[model samples]
Target: MKSRRRWRWRWEHRGFALGLALYTLLLLLLVSYMLDYGARRGRALGDWAWEGQPPPAPPPGEAAAPPAPRHEAKRNESEDSDEAGPGSRAGGKRHIYLHATWRTGSSFLGELFNQHPDVFYLYEPMWHMWQALYPGDALSLQGALRDMVRSLFRCDFSVLRLYAAPPGPRDPLAPFLPGGGGGGGVNLSTASIFGWRTNKVICSAPLCPAAPRARSDVGLVDGAACERSCPPRALRDLEAECRKYPVMVIKDVRLLELGALLPLLRDPELDLRVVQLFRDPRAVHNSRLKAKQALLRESIQVLRSRHRAAEPRGLPRRHPLLPPGAAAALAGVHPRQQHRAEFFLGGALEVICQAWLRDLLFSRRAPAWLRARYTQLRYEDLVLEPRAQLRRLLRFADLPSPPALEDFVLNMTRGAAYSSERPFLISARDAREAIHAWRERLSREQVREVEAACWEPMRLLAYPLSGQEDGDRQEGGTVPLQMFV
Candidate 1:
């Protein structure tokens, strides 16, 4: 009887141990699957990605090495060399950043670089970064933004993949249907994902033979393939090409705080030159208002369409279910929405004026080394005398004043007429008219208000206040206080 009891106990215990081991193995597998799923979801969701705390820094000795200066332009090259053979990556590269705010003629300036066969131009790579961290969440976001830019400069476009992913189906019901049948789904073309004009120009350039072929069959390949194949290779070739080219230029309007990018300028590896572009405050404000109005009209139309669609489901005409904060957060992602939100929040003009003041002060206070790399360019000056200003700019950047450069400027400006309200198109017509057009557009009171808020910076930047300012102060009692609507 004792032998029999011992055998039974042993059998029970062995069975229980086996069961426990199997359960543990199954649990481990399940956890691994969950982690993989979460990572894939994160890549697809962009801003909604589960970006927990930032990763810890590497140990002191393991940190990344600073970039080395790779290329230096040859001053002895003939002017015709500008149109010569494929750009060589044999020497150190020249990097130029054209920093500006909205409504400034930065697009035109950027195009000047774009037209150069030897120059590889990037248009607002930071636009994706801004969308990912909209409303600028301060230190963390700022650090991320700078890091993204650093990666781009070094020819690593992997960071951009975070924002390049196509958003998953927003409507739940569509997934159940064949072909994910949602009529209004987000369609992200290669051109749209990358900039339209920038992509067109880059593809046609000699370095990217694969690009033009890929463009013809854009629908066949997925975004992932395009992301994998094009940007990385293009950037790599450009990095190599930089050795032969005089300069590589990047233009961005979102960099309102120039001081934040001081690290890049100070980097010994990067021969970075900064061109600070500013427009008249009044013109900037007016352009912003016009854009906001157009966007608001579009938003209203979208809301109405949603209301019509919801009627069959017995839903409210307005999306009353969303909290104000949630709606505002959604709106904040887009520039136009942010503009409207700011207008209602008041002090829109003050905000623009303050930005001008802050940037001017930051530029003025830059250290000697940084100041050496910096050059200020006014929109008025660029527009008024394209050839002379561009010649000066190229010389400052150490680029040859090739005849091709002259042809590019004349072709770009004369081909498209300049319009303050519509700045995307290049206009060669009298740029001076666009300069002070804001004076006539803004009312006397509005002009006075802007001038009052921005007098110091305006004076410092050499922008004269309208003579009507004195008259407005005298009639201050009767003049209704106006704000940006």
Candidate 2:
């Protein structure tokens, strides 16, 4: 009887041991499967995140255009190769940044610098950043944009390679490229830049044999002629050309605030100066609406930044007011979705006004040294008094207003026709007409909306509110220029 009891106990112990071993094996298998699945997910996420280069889970209301082919190369081939650190400035160069927003007459403002024989100007060089990282919140991309501009100021063209991807089919510059492929260390040329055809440095001697060197007397270089004559010279060659100029002017509408640029301003080596441009909000809104389709992607991105900043951490990813198909509109595949486009456009304008107000407040309280380095210009003032304003603008930059430059300015502002269709194109236009075009173009309600949204900034900037008499307006008095003499 004792032997039988002991055997029973041993059998029970063996059964419990077998069960424990099976359970442990099953747990191990589950863990292995989970790890493999997680790794696959991480890689998939990496494609959109660019290995965490951009932020995650893009704002819900937006969709990025299909990302351009990724360029994976060694560290030497990247913009990281730039010698200057983020705070380090370039010496022996007077760097000027035209700080403005879209449709604020900034293109024309930039062209003035581009025409100067002594200035090497880059029109929206950071545009490549916005394009390559489409739908990335403007706030998140600010660092990368700032870095690119820093490198460009130092004449480091390798920064361009970081965004060197093949142009999309809808890209206007696509047809200009003779050949195209993008990969690690792809050989980029002048054709790869956004306004390359109009770039005087690329169109002139040593880079393109057919075109004469840029001079005030030369006026605007024939962009078409330059496109036909200039083949794709290496970007390194362009950088060599960039080094020859004393003044480097970069005009970009992407950088939204004056405060964000304090680091660059403080860089002793750069000797950096800023020219901030402002326009009447109503006029800006009108211009934006007219070019709604072309501006769709940018509008969505701006709105995304505004939404992200305003929303609480646990709130819904999308704003309640944002319409469905916002993503589709961004992708350019849903042209029929006009409502989505308009909502984004209006939201973007509101955000722009708020940003401008923030800039205005910051500029008012800046240190004396910073104030000395910054200047504010009004689009209306520029157009209303071209000769005087042009002289003032040049004086601020320490550039002389040559006879040829004066003529160029006059011709541009006094031209006969303004093409609404190709609004982005840089050409001559009736300045007075362009400034007041909003009065007739925008509906009364639209004007009211802008005035309400931008009332604080408008009041401070001396813009007249809707329904107010000219005599009653703040600007009725002689408004002093916030300029550094």
Candidate 3:
């Protein structure tokens, strides 16, 4: 009986020991789980705090880097008007900028690059890619930059809709810019290939008269407002396109005003290369007459209630340098007399010549940025020897001329079918009299008027017009503007 009781007590003690061991194991597991869970939660919270949101899927086939907090990885630089500003274009040090003038053969240049297998050329991007995010003053440097970034990421459909809606006098972009108009849908094709949204010249795209019922609508824009607000986008898109080709070309014709273009394009990261194409004064006069007539027609076509006769303004005053030979002969005319003189002598022709004379200097004294980035080219050289000229240009820009770039050149040379210059096309023929075309293109009286108007700008540009006596009559009818040697 005593032995049995001792054995039973020992068994009871063993059972008690087993229960305590099981309890201890469970407590240890619970503490370990709590610690592990806390660690994971801390890590996730830390990541969220740093990164604004989950990183987007990387570009196809490229590894997406882990997103740092939006604050951590973002750069704080000079304020840009919208997204895709200099920072975006410099997407890690690759950038290109093309500065070509209107009719300086830039459209052909655009075609030349757009044909490249690796190149995706964007035309006048400054005018085409603008998406004004809100209704207010035109895009500020900061505002433009931010909105461009938003364009890259999906926009608030509502904002895009508002930007797209048009037909109002004060375009949504008016506050941000001086003129009007905006681009249509984003070019998803460009974004997919080169990671950018690019457009050509900024023009009004006809869209159905639609209003944004919800956020999904991005309609078309009015035309003029586009001019005022699109430059930043053009600059931004060109900068992006350059990343892929590292050689982008652009021609913003609206940049006719120096006040509109230079500051935005002066960014160092853009690697801008400008080409100031020129023609002889004779050729300039010819082109100006055509341009004047065309503009006059355009004004008539767009004859708004506020018709301001869209004729070219004091173009002579625009330049500080006039040629000494052609212009110096007229230095004695007065201002009021010049306007009156236009009717008696070709007043229109005098205005053009004087403006051109002043521009020669103005072109030279352009801002340091343009001066540093540009190379001058003549129109004749571009047309006659495109390949050779392009090669030299490539060399200047530190780019290798491709073996088959001649193919591109052929397209430019052979693409357009313009009629050979007719006598009337280049200039009005000397009716019956042996016309001293240059001297007679503008009357002495008209020349005198221009001399006064063009003198100030001509002086600023240090224009040394060829100080030669105007022969009352050249031996034959010759336009002295050209060096026909």
Sliding window of 10 residues with minimal summed lDDT for model 2 = 46-55
Runs in model 3 deviating more than 4 A are 1-101, 125-243, 257-268, 281-285, 288-372, 407-485
Q: Largest lDDT belongs to which candidate?
A: 2
What do the candidate models score in CA lDDT, each in turn? 0.51, 0.69, 0.37
Model 3 scores a C-alpha lDDT of: 0.37
The weakest ten consecutive residues by lDDT in model 1 span: 476-485
Top candidate, metric TM-score: 2
* Model 1 per-residue lDDT tens digits across residues 313-394: 1111221233333333233222233345334322444544554565665555455555667788766666656788788787
Off by over 4 Å in 2: 1-91, 167-185, 212-216, 310-338, 472-481
lDDT measured at residue 226 in model 1 versus the true structure, 0 to 100: 31
- Cα miss at 429, model 3 (Å)? 22
